[model samples]
Target: MAAVGVGAFALALAATWTSGPLATGIGAAASAVYALVADLLQPSQRVHAPGGALLRTAAGRVPRFGRLDRPELAGVHPADGPGDRRAPPPYVERDAEPSVRRALEDGGFVLIVGESTAGKTRLAYEVARSRFPRHAFVRPMDRSALAPAVAVARRRRRAVLWLDDLENYLGADGVTAPMVDELLGRRPGRVVILATMRSEEFRRYDAREESRLTGSDRDAWRVQRDVLNAAVKIRLERHWSEAEQLRAAAHREDPRIRLALESGDRFGLAEVVAAGPELLTAWQNAWAPGANPRGAAVVAAAVDCRRSGLRRPVSREWLQDLHRPYLAERGGPDLQPEPFAEAMAWACQAAYATSGLLIGNYSQGYTAFDYVLTASDLPPVPDHLWDALLALVEPADAYDMGLVAHQAGRLPRAAAALERARAGGAAEADFLLAIVTGDRGRPRHAARDLLRVVERRRAALGAAHPETLAAVHQWAFFTGESGEARAASAAFVRLVADATAALGAEHTDTLAARHQQAYFAGEAGEVDTAVRELAALLDVRLRRAEADHPQALAVRRSLIWFSSLRGDLAEAERELRLLLTDAERALGPHNPHTLAIRSTQAAFAAQAGRTEEAIAEFTRLVSERSRLLGHDHPHVTHSRLQRVQGLIAVGRGAEARGELTEILEEARRVLEPGHRHLVLARSLLAPPRHEP
Candidate 1:
């Protein structure tokens, strides 16, 4: 049928050479016939394999059970018989096996979270094979492979989406909440999304108080959180239970299991069998004086590269360039390091019938072993390495590194990495760079950069595209932040109308614009109007979201603030007290929203003629904020300024002056010269001298 359709298409094209109406009609009819046949003969994207065995995926070829890498495993290979070379180790059922099997059968998102060498992947593999023997597998290689693999899996009557190291698929171009929702929304028990993540990475993504995240980081974290919430999480402890140990003892006929049982007192049976401690011991011994010192340096460099946010492999040249610093720090000339080529060889040499400290060849680049990476409790990536990595890493990697730096509060390093990413043609780098610039106190600069982003996104994604609209939203926000509140308010009004028209009034983007419109209107001094609109918006938000939802809380806070502006101080205070209680209960007292409410309550007390009390509260809050969020955090700076004002009000000019000086220095170190906090601090430090 497909061949016939192709022939008909060819005939139709040939018929177009004739100019008569009859010929034209015949060509059109034939073209339509070919289209019909072509549609009928379209090839399926579904996986094709015999029942009872998983095979290929849309992402790529699937590795069989024995071929799968079991991290840190060392010892005799467990085979079916004396001569069988490709069989896996004897199966020891875990305590979570029944639950995991049930999750697979029930089908949604199943995640196994554990530390390295905890047998997470092995457990998942065993359960999936036994429970869903006929289900096809789709294993994405990276974020880029995820969507296509999912689409391909959806075509199958039953399939499994296998994601290992879940963090790799979580970010801007990665697995998102909407994607997971779409997959689960389809035939409920047909496709099971199976994933594994290290415990540390899971906690980072699972952080509840994400108020420290800004801009794109906040958006990405929200997506990750939503996906995590939807998953049936199963925690796998590194230590084996008594029942598990007994099960391993049953498999004692397998020498590997016997050896593991003997040494498994400290680590789990799986860990000992996988040679986890042996690998760690080997790596440490390599760093001894006159040992594989250069090779150890190479391993250290690779580990630090990963720690610094370089996920992909690094070239031999890159490692050679990085290892020198590690050598220098480890008594460079005194140690008399081996030659570079010899070091590379030693690092890649396999030990304990398992992987080396570093893996990969000279031509293909290298990456550190997972065991080494997880075990090393290294300090921060050196300044020199940050610069070198930013210079050497690919644009996409550089962008991710910038995000990591930004989240860690390393503003200057983030700017440098994002700048490099932008230069290397990573488009979203501009958006993140603008945010970092704003955080550094250059809102004007951020606004200009956002304008560029807006133009680029509009050209590429169209004016009404959600991403373009987001760029426009940020541009308007920074414009207002740069002291053009009226212009920003006008922009938000236009955005609200456009978003409502394009995406409907209740769409998240539209509501976001409306929220911004109301707040900026208040900033522009239309207090009564802001208050009225915010109240209406809050009602809509409460209906659509939980009362404790961040958006709803924000709207409520804005409405209360504007109501205070309308000379309703008592009502504002009452509302704030209620809000403070709710925020503390729902988001914890240390949450940013809760702290902001506390700050507002303190300010309101001062406004209501309790300056001394307000000053004392501000002082206490400043210390708490500094302790929890670091001293250079913007929240702490704002609180300090408020405290200085309170001190000046109480005739403590001497103390106020000293505090103001410190604030000025901190602002200079972390903020832009034009930042409002920096400008205010300078004014307080050098008040105008009056001429009598």
Candidate 2:
């Protein structure tokens, strides 16, 4: 018991530290004196030993540790999780098996932690088969039914909770959230918790979870800490010894292969051991006939929605559309219904892989990783990623793929893919196209899409539904951008009223609508109203949000612009400098918001006749933006044009003309024909192209 208990929670050992010394050993007389002292000094000094054969006690008998060395564990193949029809044959006992079994014996919670695909699930299966024949596997996607699941498990002779992906479960169904509480509430030997957590998710588990705790949740918080502290943590490593690798392949003729694979940094072998040489691809082939179209579509959708360290939601409808062509087989002259069983089989396999990329729901799909697992594991993006995406995805799924490109600002790729989507009966892609239109500097065109989005949502959902109101608010905001300031102001005024009444005034969406309404007042020639409303809003924003919140910084930018308009150059300059410094610190110098501020500062300098200073600032802005957002991007071109203006202001019109010609030519090639920057550049080239 002692040998198996190595590194079993340091806190437990610490608790026992003074107890031995405190219990003075005259057997009876000294023990009585010690008891009296303990009662006087520490009323809470009672230590309950864990339930184990070893009397650590106030515990039930500790279960015996079964034999855990190689003989029982070794097999030629991989093991299956619960209910697997053909779990690969169990392999040589993982070194982790003993700890897992021992941890379960002492019974509270055991976390099997490891990197993605690092054999955590495989080890778990071995532990479950050897120890717990009846256990409940709790998953995040099935969380709504979690209470019934635990209730069912608790009915059994020996209930074991098999929880995997603890991080996702933190915010899942009700029972899953009270996981630690439930574990501690149970009698130790009566129930045991076996769980696995990806190391990265586990590292951030507290951040995602702890914030939800209210001030009134002190007891829950304490129990959570105690549960985590009491958990027997087994961290699985990716390394395998030369002997083990060779022995794993003992039936093979290759002698040197195992040695080479076991050598330095062979991450590939970990994937092989965990899922096979083609971990993810193997599933596709294995489930091909059963899930011909469904699984592939799900995989593609997941691939398209990859985000960084955050799960992106994908709709089930989009996945269904992708699955259509394969199901119906129109080209084959036969219209057939989708094979419900086949699609379901794939869905089950995908969602149930010990730590699969996707977690399925009837209405949606979720990836535990922000990016597709395979793409994330690859080398850094090559220069031609756009080309790669276009080549990799099918034409039918191109709209979803295009939405990814559009949202990410890959305009050229976004344009092509979106055009394909629009052609393919994907009406939703039109909304994304509108956003792309606005981004490409044709706000009026974007306004049309925004209107459609608002109308469609308003007609389908009620006017006060959050999604409908959100769409309305977006339409309202777009009017100001479309150069309809008076219309924008009126729309926002109505929006602010609607949002404030429906949602509370302090809600983020309401506040934003209020802020934009205030900004629209200025654009509509109500400067005093804009100034007063923005000033009050800025104070509230600064108080409510973080120090450098985007809204507050935007408010500061407005104040500087309006103050500059009122000819308060000194005040405007001072505030702009502070805003620039704070913005740069908060959101790196090359961030789009920070660069916008820089452009504003440079324009202010030029307006103030600080020609050289403006030129210097604009030069740096152009160079930094070109690096941050490619040379042909509108952001860089705008800065380049501003720098050209600064040059012309300093009596370098000849040099300005040269730079202007290059920018205009690039604008002609890369930007929309009537894009604002192109219009600005052409105006600068007109007669009386005087310095600003």
Candidate 3:
């Protein structure tokens, strides 16, 4: 269709060059013929052609000038010529406040006010379009044109008059009291007026006049502001952490960029330019240090602020505002300034050398960055500082940070931090040390260390104490994770008994102990007992903790896995749906927990009869996991295997085969050959071939 239209247009132009007046007549006649043919053929009926067919079909339906098509008229009125037709107003997508749309629908005039680029004009157009879809839309060029446009719209009786950037129209006179009174007194009809103004400008209008026109006095405006504030919602946009950002910069194939990211200095585009060759050299270094650009920036800024006589410890808000202009001046867009500032604040707050008197307080606030910042500035050698710093050195804190660093694949740092923390006298320090040692391939030492922590905690705090029992439980779990199943089972049995007695059978702590016991039982070749224990615990959790609670959802997920092991795919799928819905609502749509549930559901769906649905779900899950968790993460690899299985079940065997081959290669690289996930990947590859 597009090709045919282009051909006709070319012919029309050729005819025009040959003869002026007669050519114009020929062009008009040709356009009419084309329009008739389009009407008869019904352009919408053609769908198989690619490229511009859809565009041609849409253009063919637009209102024309006299008998001439829209395109023919456009050719006559060239875009740049004086008095040439302006392009039809851009279609504004209806995607804003529902209340504003409702008011427009009910024939009420609207005055929208917000900061510039706050989507005010776009929102106004959307509301107008939705309310008067079939009517002509007249937008006045300025305020002087508004009254005339409104008069025309009123006469038309089915038109909407919009005055965009209405503040410009109001001028210094401030929406004159008399003019507003006249507008309010105008007779009601099909015509409606919609306008937008800056919030500050709107305030300058006479109160009585504004009230009469907008039907909202100053008190009402305050109420609206309060309501807007109360109902404002925040959405989390995807952002990279400092470590992730460094990894991304490294992957971009620019050595200088990699080095700048790794320097742990305050990094913006300027720093990248400044570091140039040094950055490249650092990237080339075989063992360059991990980047802490955010951290360095925070420290640098804090020092500068203090030196400049700023009273407050460099705050996250202050750092962000300072960095904004710096980044802008360096020709860089504002990107994750908050996190970078937060990282700086944390460094200043956590700096061990900062005076306690200046630090003020150290507490585990909502954000880890805040906690670290508060901890860093503790006073030198004060009793509270000593106590707080001692607490920081405790095994629990060290162990937590160590585990996080380890999971993030910073093994050396995790090991060093854990070792230092253990040395500072954490009762659970040995447990953390054991895990780090195991990660470093010293399994025997790891097991020994874990056992020592359990023994020492039991001896010092007594076997019944929460700390002693927790140590015992974690030691056993880590032992199993490290591949010492027999020893782990023995530890688990003791943990189960002690936890049940001390924490009570239904307590979450005891339930956690039982959960570990179930896992150990499965490893020790007691599958039936494991299933029984897990089922009982799941039932209790469902009844006690709401199904959506994280702990309860976790237990439900376990039940699905156990059911799958027992070849009860139907039951597994039912549980997966419930868990998926609960996780989606509680943890949010794209959260890791929800993604895990979706992955499980995909596997179960394939196992059941919903193969096509399974394939679709798995495909989405694999893509999301790859984007969010990285392709090499265990979860992503697992999801790929599930996807292959889903594809095979849906009879897309060729595609499944290719996916299986990829999964096999990935699994070999990232997992032990004997790993359960690797085995699953292999199983998916064994399916027979068939067409999609």
Candidate 4:
């Protein structure tokens, strides 16, 4: 509005220098030009993030190793830092540092994989800081902030997406393949994605075959696999190598390194130097004899809370309430527990003149030392702890805990926590609850839940908001899962249009909607339309992302099936063979996509009348998929069916009938009533002989 006024004023000023009709015409043209230029002058606004280092060079915030505070190191907390004590030691370079720096310098996703306190975060931060010292640094607190953080980094030109402890940003509504592709492809070398993950967490995402997962695990892993695959992974060993220890010996001038060296080759140099084992030992010893058993219980409660995904610090009052069950479980009054004040003091006492079992003061509340979580052999989180945590933790914390529980396969507990979170007005819980509901095999219920969430989100956050759009996307998926393929296809059509308008035609979300649109279109029997749509989408994805990118590969996979359905079986088989080569080269022979393509090729061969060759191929594919994804997985079922068909073709009807009977029984139990596989298996089974 202000720009329009200024444009009018400019028009009037210009008109004063001209004459009559020409003056009026010139002024009008000048006015239009002024307004157009004003509209084009809009610049990128710097959005403020509450946490993480904002190392924007334009603002003079440059990142230095220690002087500029790094994101809290992997194990060390703010309360555990070297304050009065001399700086622990100069950083001994890890073996993976060169590879890490190389990845950072090249500007793409770089993941440092290691166990806790193996110095994943430290290695990533140091390498990133050294490489991109002046670039903006963004560390989103959770998955919710990821897209916005990426946007901020994009605007800053040179930036780093710092994802320390990468688990917090994974799973549903988390970072995925397309997001990474856009970030890396759009800006190229202007930005870098630096992340750290625990070795176990990385392994969970590194699934060789998608059939190994079912329901929500399958859905989540599909995206996670692509994202992890895109990353240049650098592994850091928990125990330092002999060369690393010898290098640490040179730094023994620092007493911490000298002390750590005295432990021989048993532990990581950083783990020992950071007092991780000592703090854990101190906490455990507090449980023995007449020591602070009550205090140990309090710390144990805190650790369990942390393990349960409560990232925020808890109050002493809440800890007091939570610790009682632990105290009672460990012999109750017979343990001769100390007074609350005395116990609190003992638990807070520092170990090795460094960190205490539980860190933080009264003001900040208390958090269990992070190292204790990595080092200890704690049991599964008890029901009492889950019950108490849901009751005491805030809605946001409960939401986080719910996600962790859902990821850990504790569905009932996850549902309960997510329900509490929803009741407390945590909007994200609604979408997650819908996913959890679907995971529990209640697709109709899940669709209804998502419908409500979509309506509410649209009303509250506007129809164009990403969260609302995401809810709509999931609701469409659940609608399809509930057997409403036509409705889901229609939903994706509208979503594609809306997402294109809001997030641009080339945006990942828009492309994702297009992919889904093609899928449901095929499912709804519009195979020709699906083929055209997927082919176009694949072209766009190939232009933007690498040819080997997951989205592109997925589009090609769908297109092949649709093409086959369109009666271009020979062409489809040839395309599938080409796709198999690319899949094997990019994703490995054992990857789900590669295996699926091979299975399809074998099926095509059986259809093409090469029974002997197809039988052998199906035999191997079935065995491999069964081993990876389990015998009951849909992929295995499909392969076994193909093999049975091969047996029938080769005049082994009796053998085929026996296998078909077993498959029909298994399908009846594992598949939905209307599932195509179940229908196929039942149809293939011959009727029992009528003994008149």
Candidate 5:
């Protein structure tokens, strides 16, 4: 299709030699077509590529486009006008408030979305006002504005990035794509990017690009999706009840009225909001040919539900043919736009609201891009349309769909999609299937699947390929989980050597392989050698990488365990503190990595005879870990065990025994019987025997 576009561009170039309105339009349209294809052909950024020492050392000094153009004072809210100094409006409780607060507190990101009238911006301000009372509310409308905001936030050590109508700035090829990327990529916990966009707009931004992607700069959606997958999504209900309508009318008064009346209140975008969360079908029924704003949405939604990601879009001719029948069935062919073409023209206008386009050309039919509609959506496709499209295309481009679903943590949907991919002979899906299976607690099956990938890729891509080696390493990992520590250990040793020889000693894969080798070696009972090897790896890493680089932090992490295993409690304590400091500095105090290190810090403190401090640390870790990783996760279980040990250490044996009893039951339920923590818990809780 794009090749055809290129050919059309050549014809338009020639036509431009003759000056006329038709020629001008043709030339401009052809250039756009060519540009779209050119954008598609651009290289995908390697976001996951490892950063080296230079980048790490220059972290704080790196160029930043994350700052806000106008940063509000944290200490004081600007008076609206004429000394109308006042408190913000009271927050209306919503289903998403808890989740929004949690995401903000977690120091990650959140995207609030709804229709124009859904109060998305209001929700964002309320959230910030509630959670970040002491920090500035920084909002940026353009990419350039982000840098100043980020700069202030970083300097202050905290700030809320209040981005309203996010699509205006971060949409595909928007002016501030680089700035948005920089803000999202580097800010982490230092600055929280709380952005709002209409769901309709957001859904459209990547609908076309993602569906037809050959690989390109337009893959920003992929990055944004991945980043925001970690973020909390607060989508205001698209369905508006009568009660909500009344509340919006009564409470959301104009800012000017409040200012003149000397009432304390923050200005809101309420007046700009259009009413009605009307169903799409109803909207379409109501729409007429004369300047109907809903035409594009109707078209976008129709395409979303009808087009399969794997197939070429339905041609304009095909759409017209189908739409004619659709209108007839609704008994509304006489509604307003007598001709199907006129209705389609309206659709083109409405579609600008979403990330959708109606491409028309002499040679090809109109096509839809990345719009997706599901049964859950307000404007979901009617069953007849869905059935037609189902027959028209393959179920989906399952692998691509599965990858996106997996990243979004939609496990069941991911599995269903990948199952289709596997049926279609895509080997990549199997690898993710294995991960999904493991997460579902089917380790045996997952291990078998992973091993198959490793063997297959090793033969096809060669042992030296980074992907093949990664598979081997992952297979070895699941091999351990599926119960073969010694074999897995041997495999890791070989992988480390192979990685070093093929990729060079300083390669990220080699470093990761070495780290794995050290752990498995210890598990295989080569504790002394493992300790020495880990210490040696740490030395090499510290020399080559930034002191707090993730790899170096990982190395120190392993050494702390080795130090403990070697019975050097003081050395272990020192390493734990060092690891904790680095982790806190690099990932933030509340980061999962930092929290894990904190647990180890407690264990070290306990072993070093800091009884009171150890108990406090362990208690903190147990509660935090439970909240973060869940109670059944191994990390939480292990932390609990350490807490038990601390109780025993303090001669609170009865309390220790009681805690062990609870842990023993929990271990039996959540862990394998022979699991190290399970075994330890059993021994600790075993009843004392009296001499017979």
Candidate 6:
């Protein structure tokens, strides 16, 4: 009985041990079953990978499975080597062409030139393989490595030496006369040299050499045409013939080709042909049955158009017209649903790639195209796919859209997009939301949200990140604008210090911080300190950013106002006139900032006994302001008060009194009685009793 009990316990222990793995296996099997069910449930939304099998097969064929066997060549082809048993270079198939073969075999030196991405590097590889089948094709390891490469070539009795992207290592900085001399002086029998370079790179090399190809001037090609003239030069132009296009289309299995051919819209056929065979092949393969070919054709068309110099963000009407016939041809107005969807997707991608030319910061004006590209492929989407969509969307508009929705009290949509952006780890989204939450009239609850965004951004993007720094500056500016002077001052001080350190003391960001610091310092009751800071910042900006630059002009205007506050009217007028002229030139007439600066100058002139000049300036300013910003605007009221002061300065007491009364009435109507401008107008009227 004891033996049987012990056996039972052992059997139970064995079952327990096996149960964990069995449960894992069952869980994995269940997951697979669910995946299949999910896939079947959504046949319309599936992603297929075609080259995956081929890539896996190629990966397996690699000798070491994952790592390259030779350390010197790393994981690239063995022919791309410098340190192994100097084996012969790999032969390129293009060598089968007699002219190219003869050039590689007999030419003293060869200069391979082509545009970027024009197969120049591949051609160089082929040349190395054919010329030195038994010798290892060693490439220059670095700018310093060129010498060692030359030495190795000398040691090997017969070798084919290739310099891939040689222009990068042989331009002005990369080349020295001594290096070239050494390379050229080496025996021709032991070393057959070849180098690949772009057209622009060749120009730079020619410039350095002062007009000659130093070592082997006998074998140089100015243009791709020059290569064609050579016994070995092979020019690979874009495939344009119908046969070539058809072959490419067949390779890609793109159904659109048939549709396009059937549609008979031939206006841009030449442009389409110039996109090259490889692109056509890619589209065909991507669009074949079972392949989603989402935006392949659209992207291909856009790329083709751009190469032909037609700016991107092609009209939707143009794309529709181009693809309509193709669609009609495929199924006579009943094309397969999947293929139709794929064609639209391709067009959207093309539209995005060509839109606005990737300008600085924002993509200027392709809103329609970006919208279509972003809204596709949702639900169980890959992270990279989501990121690619976002990258194509303009950030400023995305921010503005979120803000507009938030301001209109459309919280759900705003929150949804913001949450999506946040989940996707976008720093700009957090910064923009922080701005929205901190704005006046927002609920007190929003402050916590703003702070949360601020904290998250600081953590993710770092304290000195440009966007993070801008957000912090905005927070401080908003605090000051909203009447929290102390908090604003503290925030400004920290921001100024950080910006000064990170951007360098003289950087534009540092100067902007200093300008804000000056403003906030005055607001916080440090007027004298503010004046000193503004003066220094203005001087630095004038010298560095140029006096006419917006930042420098702004700083100068600030200095003028600070000077007026300190009772320095003469200095204020001097600074004001200089800023006004520059502002007029830079910002144009009727700009609010320019008008404000002019008004400040008028006040300074009135204080300095230049009444006539002040009255003329003020009258013009008041008229413009009344026309531009209504008669009741604060700036208009301010201009009226300046005119009254100018009249008083010239002893026109009656006119001054009348002007002051008008200014007071306007101020009373547009501003509070105790407001600074109203008080100033009342005081100016009190001083005058003399008639004109």
In terms of lDDT, which candidate is strongest? 1
| Clash number for each model | 3, 7, 10, 0, 17, 19
Per-residue lDDT over 245-352 for candidate 4, one digit per residue giving the tens place of the 0 to 100 score = 888889777767777777746788777766777787888888875888999999999989988878666766778789999999998888899987677667766646
lDDT of 1: 0.72
Better of 3 and 4 by TM-score: 4
> Which has the better lDDT: candidate 5, or candidate 6?
5
Query: How high is the CA lDDT of each candidate model?
Result: 0.72, 0.54, 0.47, 0.71, 0.54, 0.47
By lDDT rank, best first, the candidates go 1, 4, 2, 5, 3, 6
lDDT of 1 by residue, 251-275 (tens): 8887777877887788877776666
Candidate 6 per-residue lDDT over residues 1-692, each given as its tens digit: 64345434544433343322221111112222333333334334433222111111121221111221121121121121122222322222332234455667653455565543333554455545545556534454333455555666667656555555553344112334344445546764455666655543344323222111111111112221222222133443222345434543452333333332332243122223112222334444554444433333334333322222122233332333333333333343232335443354333232211211111011111112111122223122222322333344334223333433443333333444455555555435664454444332232333345566557769998998755666566666656655566677778789888987787888655667778788778877788888899888877866774676656666777767876787867777776777788788876676666887888877677767778998999999989977654566556777887777777777789988877776676566545335567668777767548898
lDDT of 3 at 490: 76
lDDT tens digits by residue: candidate 5, 643-663: 888888788999998888888
Candidate 1 — which residues are off by over 4 angstroms?
1-87, 94-113, 127-163, 169-195, 202-210, 215-249, 255-296, 330-353, 371-377, 455-464, 486-522, 525-674, 688-692
Considering TM-score, where higher is better, how would the candidates rank from best to worst? Answer: 1, 4, 2, 5, 3, 6
Q: Is candidate 1 or 2 superior in TM-score?
A: 1
Highest TM-score, which number? 1
Off by over 4 Å in 4: 1-66, 69-84, 132-163, 168-193, 200-204, 208-231, 450-692
Determine which window of 10 residues in candidate 6 has minimal summed lDDT.
357-366
Using all chains and alpha carbons, the TM-scores for the candidates as numbered come to 0.68, 0.52, 0.40, 0.56, 0.45, 0.35
Clashing pairs in 2: 49-56, 49-57, 52-62, 53-62, 74-92, 78-88, 307-370
**Candidate 2, which segments miss by more than 4 Å at Cα?**
1-380, 383-385, 392-400, 403-407, 425-427, 669-675, 689-692
The per-prediction CA RMSD against the true structure, in angstroms, equals 14.2, 19.2, 29.0, 17.4, 18.6, 21.0
Q: What lDDT is obtained when candidate 2 is compared to the true structure?
A: 0.54
